[model samples]
Target: MRYRLSIEDMEPNHWVVWVLDLPACFSSAQTPVDAVALAPGRISAYYSWLSSHDSSLPVITESIEVEIVETFHSFASTQDQEYLVNAFFEDDRRPPNYWDVELALRLLQWTRQDLLKVVQSATQEQLSRPMVCEVRGSIAGIIKHIAGAENWYFDQLDLALDRAQLPDDPLDMLKAVRTNTRAQLVKLMGNERITKNCDELWSARKVIRRTLWHERDHTQHIAHLLAHL
Candidate 1:
C-alpha cells in the first residue's frame, strides 16, 4: 500500500511526516529525507500497536511505501506561530465512530504510561538539570511540555480546561491534564465539529491526532534522555 504523507517542515531542521490515513501517526527527523525515511517503521509500529487493542487493521507487511501528498513549511518555529496543515484533509472531517474513539483512548492511555515509566526513578537534580535547546529545556521541561500541550489540544476545539489551577508536580500535572483531556476526547466520539482559530484548523480527529503524536514523541524523547543518565 502506498501511504499518503503530510510533511511539516519548521525552522531549524525540524521535519515531521504525518501519515494522513492513520490518526496521530507521525515521524520526525532533522532533515526531510531522514524524516521520510523513518515513516515506514512508524507505519509498521502503528499497525501493531493499533491491533493490540483493536484487531481490525490488516496485518502489516515488512515492506512499506509512502508518498508526500501534502507539504507545509514555516521558516520560524511552529511553537512560535500558527502550526502546519491549515486546512483539514478529506479524512480529517470524517467523524470518529465509537470504535475509533475507543481505540484512540486506549492508545493514549498506553502512551502516557510509557512516558511515566521513563521518568519514574529520575532524581530531582536530574529532572531539573538545565540543558540548552529549543522548547525542550530539561527533563522537567519535557514533562511540563507534555502536560501543557495535552491541555492546549483540547483548547483548540473550545473544550477548555482550567489551566490556571493545574497541579505543579510534574506527574500530578500530567495525570490531571490527561484526565481532563480524556474526558474531552470522549465527548468527541461521533462529534462532527471542526473549528478555526486564527488561521489554524482543528477537529475532534485533529485534536486526537496531535495529542497522541505529542505524547508519543516526548515519551521517546524522555526515554532517550534517561538513557544517558
Candidate 2:
C-alpha cells in the first residue's frame, strides 16, 4: 500500500517541514502556503502501510517535490505576505541527510531565478537612479553588493572571471550582475558539500540567506516608494 501525507497550516510558520518516520526524511521551506506545508512521516509508518499489500508506497529519494503556488497577489498588503504550496510524496524513503544536496541545489536555483527576475523588471532609469541611501538606491546597491560578494567568493576559489566589473550602463550592469552571479552559483554547486555541522556551511548559507533577506527588506521599501509615486 502507498500512503501519502499532506499537511497544511497557516499559523506558526506557513513553511512546512515534512519528514518520513524513518530516521530523517523531510524538507522544510518558508515559501508558499496551503496543502503542501506538511512534514515527512516516519519510514515505519510506510512499511506498515505497505504491508497491507493494497497499495505501493513511493521510494523517498534525495529530492521531495515541493510546489510554491502564489496564493495571494504579488503586490498584496504588506500585512498579508504569507503564501503556501502543495507537497506530493510517494512510497519511497531517503537516507538521512540525503536532503542536504537537494536543498542546496534547489535554493541556488531559486535565488538565481529571483535575482534575474528583479534585474529584468527594472528599467534603465530605475537602475541609474542616484545612489542616495533611499529605497531606490538602496535596492540597487543591494543587488550590486550581492554581485560583488559573489565575485569575492569566486576570486577566493580562483575561479575565472568573465567580467572584471559591472558595466557602467545601468541596464548593462543589471545584466552583468545576473550573469556573473549565476556563474558563481554554478561553480559553488560543483564544490563538495558543506557539512551542516561544520562552520564552513555558514559562509555559503549566509550568502544565500542574505540574498533572501535583502530581497524581502527591499520589497517592502519598493512598495512604500510605489505608494508615494
Candidate 3:
C-alpha cells in the first residue's frame, strides 16, 4: 500500500510534489510542508475517482517513500553524484559492467513518474489540442511518441516485445510500454551472454544515456505543454 513520492522545487516559494507510484497525482504549494500536507487529499481523490470507474482499484495505505530533489538552489552536488555512483557500482550481485543499465533503470523510474503526472492531469480536450509551435504533435501524440521510442529502444537489445495497438488512454499505453522496457532492461542487465551479444550501438553506456535523455527531453516537453494549457 505504500507509495513513493518525489518532491522538487519548481520556483521561488513554490514546490511541486508528485506521488511517484500513482499516475497523475501531483500538487504544488508555496512551502514544502504545505506540499506534503496536500498529498493525502490528492491521493484520496485519485483513489476515489479510480474506484468509481473501476471497483477493482486497490486501496492505498499511509506508508510512503519520499525522495526530494531540490534543484532550485543548485544542481546535484558532488556528494549526491558520488552517492548515486557508489550505489550503482557497489551492487556487485548484478552482472559485471552493468552499472550503466542499473542507473538507467533508476532514472527511467523517476522520469516515467514525472511524465505520468502530466498525462494523468490532461483532459481529453487538452490531449487533442493542436500544437502552436514548431514542436510536432498534440500533447497525447507526443506521449505516444515517448512510449513508442522506449519500445524501439528495447528492440535494439534484441528483446522483441509483441507490439500491441496503443490504447486510447495515454497513461495505460505508457504503463504497458514502461513495464515491457523495464523487464527487458532487467533481463539484459542480468544476462552476461545477452549483454556480450548486443551490438556496440546498444551498449549499456549508450543505451542508458539515450534512454535517460529521451525520457527527460519528453518530460520537459510535457511540462511545457501543460504550462500552455
lDDT scores of the candidates, listed in order: 0.80, 0.41, 0.59
lDDT of 2 at 20: 27
Show model 2 residue runs off by greater than 4 Å. Answer: 1-105, 108-127, 131-142, 153-163, 186-202, 211-220
- Tens-digit lDDT track for model 2 on 1-229? 2333333232345443332222122233455333244432333433343333324544444433343322321222233344221222231112213353345345445445545566566665564566555643644665565555555444434542555555655335545655655555544533443321111222333333333334333444544543443
Residue 142 lDDT (model 2)? 53
Candidates 1 and 2, the one with greater lDDT: 1
Residues 65-172 of candidate 3: C-alpha lDDT, one tens digit per residue: 454443223133354442211111111123424665665566577677767777778888888788777365688778878777776666656664566665656667
- As for TM-score, the candidate ahead, 2 or 3, is 3
Best by TM-score: 1
TM-score of each: 0.84, 0.37, 0.50
lDDT for model 1: 0.80
Superior by lDDT: candidate 1 or candidate 3: 1
Q: How high is the lDDT of residue 77 in model 1?
A: 26
